[model samples]
Target: MRFLSGREAVLKHIFETDDEAPLTPVAVTVTVTREGRTTAATSGTAIRNGDVYTFAAGSLPLGVYTVRWDGGTAAVDTSWFEVVGGHLFTVAEVRAYDADLSADRFPTSAVVRLRDYIAGEFESITGRSFVTRCRRIPVELDGSCSPLPLVDVQATTFEDSAGQTVYAVSVEPVGPFTLAEGEGSYTAELTYGFRSVPDDVKRAALLRIRTLLFAERSGIPDRATSFQPAEGGTYTLATPGVRGSETGIPDVDAVLGRYGFDVLDDLAGVLL
Candidate 1:
């Protein structure tokens, strides 16, 4: 007797003696195959006459697969599934060994902790208070639910970076913002108390941001455009990803000093 359960695929098999006779505890081996690709095999103990065998989900991923069993008796049963995750990041949605975020493993329990850490770091770097409402929207395409659950994470704050305080009074996103399906962007209103940002500084920071946001990202265009806000508000960019926003930290300082507040810096604080 055998038991099997899964989503994408299912398997059926049994372990018994010849002629339904009671068999001594026999060693059973089960091999699973998917799309002609042989996955690993598992071993089990024989289910004596009228006995039951259970191999709960410690093995196998979500997908179509075939299960073959041989209890030293004969090649008896097979099964398959469409569960999810091909293996690691495919179904998991979140992965620990992300080179970009440099996260260890995708841990669900620490979302807020991660966000808080970013907020704290932002305050430390900019010397400003961040009053924000953080929301994580799970991203999904093809109807496959995200393991990460929340895909679109948004954190809005009035915190001023060392640059925004001087170069710009404020900036805000125009009302009626929109996001196209399968895309991401953020918008904000901006105000500049200064005459205008120096072209050299603006170009330098914009270059850094563009490089940071889209460097590893794919599917979007190789280039992007960023506009300086006339007033103090949100600096927004719609990219291939689900969102794009700004710390309103002027890039002017980036030219004067190290470009710490560029996209790389912001992501380091936020990617957590």
Candidate 2:
């Protein structure tokens, strides 16, 4: 997408007035796809640009990706851009993600989350049948320092206001996040997604989730944590009473229905 200078913001620690902030995302992850299949995507850091919220591409897959940030208002702009192998990303098309929607109906993370939580609660509460595509992908860190290289969907790709590159990782998928719920009768496409990453990139994303579970801090941001380094193709997260490695990441069932959808929230919990 051809993002106007004011249409998006660089993925960095944006300093803005609280009331001026778009929305505080507890956790977010990058999700993308190409050629009707999944790609190697990545994400990093949270950022905001005035009223415009933009997420730059990270060290994700090589191909054309329709990128957009998905944590703020549905009124937030989403544009389409193309990624090449030996060149920087190019914008092919530019338009608002939800420009046509009524101002009153623009979707936000909270609005989406509340709807999903209610649907799930409704199903569980009254057995009305809840439809969702949430699943956990276990992970293993390998072939890197105890610390994983950074990967991201757009954070790294977007140059900061200072015009310096952020070393976070990135991801590009074969497609976008999906939803098949009958109530809404609508699905979200993978225009583009964003995520925060550490310095280690060799670690497969699945293992990244396990790192969040067994390590310290939180996974929503996927911030770095203290862990014991292991030999060859693996990293470890351990403590006095507990220790673990990428070899055996566990999968926890869907505990909450965020946004009546699973793609972003599920992965968000796993990565953060």
Candidate 3:
């Protein structure tokens, strides 16, 4: 299961005996862990509601969390959940696109998985980062103009080899337009990536997600091909798979075509 960050996570488990009857243990305990570190734990009979045990894990940061339920039974039930800062599309947005979709028929977890999958696929196909990030990168300056091999550059601060801020540097639309009067190595505190994802990109992602869901629920393989005989021709229908930089969906492919670029194109053949 997955949840957005800053949202409370409610974990529940049903206890049953070997005879297929409700079994309420004398006591139940819940433990929440992240990266093998226990973050929260609770033990008591207060957590039990009849045969159902629940633990309300408070708002957690972005990361995977494991939940363990110890009901004094011979077996320990374990489950996992994830928290993300944001997604390209929200569950509400996805449901808006498909009016027939409902929480009962299609859960939010399934939708989150599909959204995450499409987001990753879009980034991989376009060779671009959609999430804003900051990092320190090594750069070589020739005392003049030097292009920073990064995309969607928002801001940068250049520092000399000794890690001192270089005041004699100016950032241009493309990269560092000017640098200090010397040839040497420098580090750049670069902040880059999109503040908001493109509308068309989100639309393409929605379409692809819808296609996948429809195929899955209808028992149809996405890659399955069928041929129909017409009065004067044969029509072949098939779903396109990801090839090269294409997503196989017409609208998706069109959107990606506008943003996709070869690695060489991104670097402009600059070795650095």
Q: What is the C-alpha RMSD of each candidate to the true structure, in Å?
A: 23.8, 21.8, 7.8
RMSD of 1: 23.8
- For 1-272, candidate 3 gives per-residue lDDT tens digits of 65666688777777656799767776777788763244463333327777778778878754567777776654467777766555677899989998877788779878877877776687777766564444467877777665666667676777776667886666666331222244577777766556677788778888988887776675544565544445666544434553433655677788888886675554554434
Please give the CA lDDT of all the candidate structures. Answer: 0.34, 0.30, 0.67
User: What's the TM-score of each model vs. the native?
Assistant: 0.22, 0.21, 0.57
For candidate 2, report its TM-score.
Answer: 0.21
lDDT of 2: 0.30
lDDT of 3 at 142: 77
The TM-score-based order of candidates, best leading, equals 3, 1, 2
User: What TM-score does structure 1 among the candidates reach?
Assistant: 0.22
* Model 3 bad stretches (over 4 Å): 12-27, 36-53, 102-110, 120-195, 216-222, 229-233, 236-247, 257-271
Best by lDDT: 3
